[model samples]
Target: MKFIEEVVVEEFLPTFRSMLAGELRERGLTQSEVAELLGISQSAVSKYAHGDVDINDAVADDERVRETVERLADGLETGDMSRVQALVEAEILIRKLERGDLLANLHEAAFPPLSDHEGPLDIHDPEGDLRTTERVLSSVRRGVRTLENTSGFAALIPAVGSNLVEALPDADGIDDVAAIPGRILDIKGQATVPGDPEFGVSEHVASVLLAARAAGSDARAALNVRYDEDVVAKLDAAGYETVEFDAEADVESAIAEALESNPQPDVLYQTGGFGIEPVVYLLGADAGVVVGTVRDLV
Candidate 1:
C-alpha cells in the first residue's frame, strides 16, 4: 500500500503537530530519548518538542527519516493519538532508519490520521470513553510485532495475518508492518509456535495468544478463554481454563462474568469466530494493550 504522501496534506499539518506533542507526553518518553534514537542531539528533540525545529531539516539527508515521516503522516491522518503512539514505539522498531530517526523523533510523528475503529465503552466505568481509537490500533500493531519476534510460535503468525487482513487493519497492513520494525514472521505460512495444529486455529486467536504470551503471562496469570465447547475442551485439556460462550454473547455480560468471577486482570482469548465487539468490551476504554480478531471488519 502507498504511504500518507499519496494523500493531500495542505490542511492537516497543524493537526498533525498537535498530535505529535500529545503523543510524546502520553508515552512518558522524553525529547532526549527521541534524539538518541534518531542519532541526533537532545537539543534537536527539544527543539522539535518546543516547535523550534523543522522535521524535514532535522533528517534532511536521511532516507529512513523521510520514509518513516511519511509513514507516520499516514498514521496521523487517522487523527488518532494511539496511531501516533504505535508509530513512535522504539522498543521493537528501529530507532534509526537509514540516516533518519523514527517519526516519533521528529515533529511529524505527532499527528497520525484518525480511524473509525473507535471501539466500545463500558457502562459501569467512566474511563472507557476516554481512550482514543489510535491506541487500539497501536496496541494491535505492537502485539503483532511481539508475536513475530517470539521464539516458539512460528506456526501462528500467518493465521494472525489472515485475521488482520479480514479486520481491515490500517496499522499492520503490509505497508507498515514490515517497515522499520520488520516482523520476524513475514512469510505467508510459517508457524511461530512449533507443533501447534493449524487446522483448527485462526489468525486472530493465534495473534492475541502469541502477543499475550509475549507480554509475560503464562498459565499463572488469570486468562479467560471464550470459545465453543470443543475448543474450550481442548484448551482445558492443555491447562487453560475455558469458558463456554456463544460467539454472539452480549459483550458486557461476557466481560462482567469473566472479570467478576476471576478477581484479577486476565488475558482474554475469544475463539471460534467471535466478533471484534467483545475485544472492545473486555479491553475497555483505558486499555494499555489489546489483541484480538474479528470474523469481519468493524
Candidate 2:
C-alpha cells in the first residue's frame, strides 16, 4: 500500500526544492551556495536545477507555493529567515495543504481507495482549516438537501430568496461561514439550488448568525424564510424563544440589541420595513438541525 506521505516526499519535495533552488540561482546564488542553504549536496542541486528530477507541476504552480518560494528566497538571500525558520514555514504550509487541500487531493488521486476513506485521515490535522472547512461545507450540503427534499419548502422561500448557512466552530467573519453560493430561489414552486455551497457567500443570513453569536447565542447555523404572524406564533408555541429585530438598522447591531435580553433565541424575525421584506430566521446547532427545524415547522 502506498502511503499518502510517500506522495508528498516523492512529488512535493522534489518540485519545491527545485523551484527554491532555481529561485536562489536567479538571485545570483551558485549551485554550491544553494546546496549549502538547502542542506543538500551540490550534485543534488545540479540535478534539480538541470530538470533531471521529475517535478510536480501542481506543487510548482500553486499560488501559495510561488509566493512562499519568493519570500523564502528573498529571506534566505538576505539572511532574514534562518534555514530552520524556512523549513518550519514550508513544513507548516505542507501540513496545512495536506489537510483536505491541494496535497490531500493529490494524495487521494494517487491512492484511489483513499478517496472512499472515511473521516479525517491520520495525516490531516483534526482542527485544520481544510478539514474544518470541508465539515462546514458538508453540513451545509446536508441542510440544503433537506430543503430540496421537503415538500412545500419552495413556498417558504422569501421574495429575496433563501440561504442555508453554517459557521465554523470559531467563525470570525463571513469567510468562516459556509453557505450556498447563490441564494435558494423558488422557481415554478420548486426550490432551485443554483450551485454548490461555499464560504463567505451569504451576507444577510451569515451576518444575522454572526450577530447572534456575538450576542451570546451558541447557534452556528441559520436559515431564512418568508415571515408571517402564524409562523412566529407557531415557533413560540413550540417553545422556541423568538425575538424581533429592527429591519432598517445595521443587521449585526440590530440582532445584538434584540438578543441582549433574550440571548439564546431559537427564532429571530424582522417585519417588513420600508423596503426590507419580512423574514424569519431559524437557528440551531448545525445546518442539519436548522433545516430539520424548518421542515418540521412548515
Candidate 3:
C-alpha cells in the first residue's frame, strides 16, 4: 500500500519548489537568496534555475499554484511573510490539492486502479468536515499543552476535573467538538492530561460550548476550571466580561438567559446545584486565546 506522502515528496515538492524558485527569481531575488528563502541548497536552486528538474505541467499550470507562488514571492521579497508562514500556506494548499483535486488526479494517473474507487477521496481535504474536526483537535491540544505547562495550573482542576474543548466553525452536535479523551486532573500537584485529544470524547465541556454557541455566542473554544470567588475576582480584574447562569436549571436555557444581556462574555460561571459541581468556563475565538487567558489567571 503506497502512501500519499510519498507522492507529495516525489511529485509535488519538486514541482512546487521549482515554481517558487522561478517566481522568486522573477521577483529579482538572487539564487542564494531564493535558496535561503525556500530552505534549499544553492546547488539545488541552480538546478531548478536551469530547468534540470521536471515539474508536472498540471501542477505548474494550476491557477491556485501560480497565485500561491506569486503571493509567496511577493511576501518574501517585501518581508511580509516569514519562511515558516510561506511553508504553512504551501502545506495547506498541498493538502487541498491532495483531496481529489490536482494531486489526486496525478496519483490516479500513476496508479490506474485508484480511479476505480467507489467515490471521491477526501483524506486530505482542507475544507472537509474531517479537517474541521482535526483543526478543533489541534486547538484543544494547544490549549491543553498550555495548561499543562502553566505553573500551578493543576490547582484549577475541580472534583470533576478540567477539560479544554473546541468546536468546528459550524458545529451543531457534540461529535463536532474535539476534547481530551479523559478529564485533565491534578496528579501529585501537577496537571496531568489523561490521553490524546479526540472528537466525541468530552461531554460536559463540549455541551457548555455548544450551549454557548446556541445562545448566539460566536465562541468556538471553551475551557472549564474550578470556580471560586478568587477566580471570579481574577477574571473581573482582567477585564473579562462575566456572566452567571443557574446551575439548577437547564444549562442551555440558563446560558441563553444570561447571554440575552451580555451576549459575548469571556467567563461563564454557575452556582452549585444538587450534586452538580460549580464551574467556570473561559470562552474565546480559539483555544489559543482561551489558554492565554487561563495563563493570566496563574
Candidate 4:
C-alpha cells in the first residue's frame, strides 16, 4: 500500500507552518531572520510564515513524493526503522527531479516504485472523532500520570502519525503531558550503503523530528557511523547535527547519556538506534516512561 495518504500535506502542512511561525514569533525572530536561516528571500519567509506559501505542496502532487513524505512522517511518529527506510527511498526519487537525465536515470535506479493508490490512505482509529483540546489534554495527563506513578524511569511514546488530524486522538494534550520538559535526540542507527539510490532512515529521522519540533520539543538528529564526520557535516548543512556514540556503546546506555547531556528536559527521540530491539528494552525495563509510535507504513 502507498504509505502516505494524499491529504497529509493539505491537512497537516498548515498546522506545521503555523507552529513554525509561532516559534519564530516566540523567539522574536523576523522574516529576515528566517530567510537568512533557510537561505531564502525575506519576502519568501514572510509568505511562508503568513501561510501564503508551502514548500511541501509544491512537490506534493507527485505520488512518490507524497508517499516518501508519509514514510518519513510515519517513521518519526512511530519510531519504526522500516518506515524510515521507505522515506530514504522516497528522497532519492525526489532528487531525481534535479538530475540531468531525470526519468532515464531514475529508470535505472532499480528501487521499488510507488503504488498507484492516489487518494487518502486509510488510517483508521474509531476513537479519533472527538478532537477537543481538553480531550487531548486529558489523555496526555493520564499517560503522564501513569509514567510518574511508575518506578525508576518513565518514557512516553505518542501515537505514530503524519497529521494532527490523525495524531490528535493519540496525542491531544501531549504538549503538557509531563511537568518536566523532554529533550528530543533523533538517532540514525544504520549506515547507508554506498551508491544506494534509496535514502530511507535519514528521511524518517527528519520527519519525526519535524513533528516533534512542531509539538514544542527540542529535537536533534544523531548517528554513529564509520563516516561520522561526513554524516555530521551533512546534517549540519541541513541545520541539524548528529551525535556520535562509541561503536561499542549499548543503545540504552547511549540513550541515557543523551538524555543526561541535554540540560533542559523536553523530549528524547532515539531514531536509528537498534530499532525495535531498544524499543522492546525500553518498554520492558522503563515502565515509568511512556512509549508511543507514529508511522505511515508498519
Judging by lDDT against the true structure, name the best candidate. 2
Q: Report how far residue 83 has shifted in candidate 3, in Å.
A: 38
Residue 289 miss distance in model 4 (angstroms): 25
Give lDDT: candidate 4, residue 24. Answer: 49
TM-score of model 3 vs. true structure: 0.63
- Stronger candidate by TM-score (1 vs 2): 2
- Model 4: per-residue Cα lDDT over 1-298, one tens digit each: 2222223344334433444443544456676654443345777557766667644433445565555544444443344645336445644653454232233222223222412211221223233222233343344344334433333221222222111111232332323221112222112321112221111223322333334334343432211111223333443454432333222355345544544544223223233343221111111011122222111001
Question: Which lDDT tens digits does candidate 3 get at residues 1-298?
Answer: 5567877888888999999999899888999999899889999999999999988788888999999999988999999999999999999998888887888777777777565443466656578654565567778887888888899889888889998888888889887788898899999999999897877788899998999999989999999999999999999998999999999998789899989998899999997899999999999999999999888788
Winner on TM-score (2 vs 3): 2
Q: Which number leads on TM-score? A: 2
Task: Give the deviation of candidate 4 from the true structure as CA RMSD.
Answer: 25.9
The model with the greater lDDT, 2 or 3, is 2
CA lDDT of every candidate? 0.34, 0.89, 0.87, 0.33
TM-scores of the models, in the given order?
0.25, 0.66, 0.63, 0.19
RMSD after CA superposition, every candidate: 18.7, 8.9, 11.9, 25.9
Q: TM-score of predicted model 1?
A: 0.25
Better of 1 and 2 by lDDT: 2
Which lDDT value does model 1 have at 99? 15
For model 1, the local distance difference test gives 0.34
Q: Total clashes, candidate 2?
A: 0
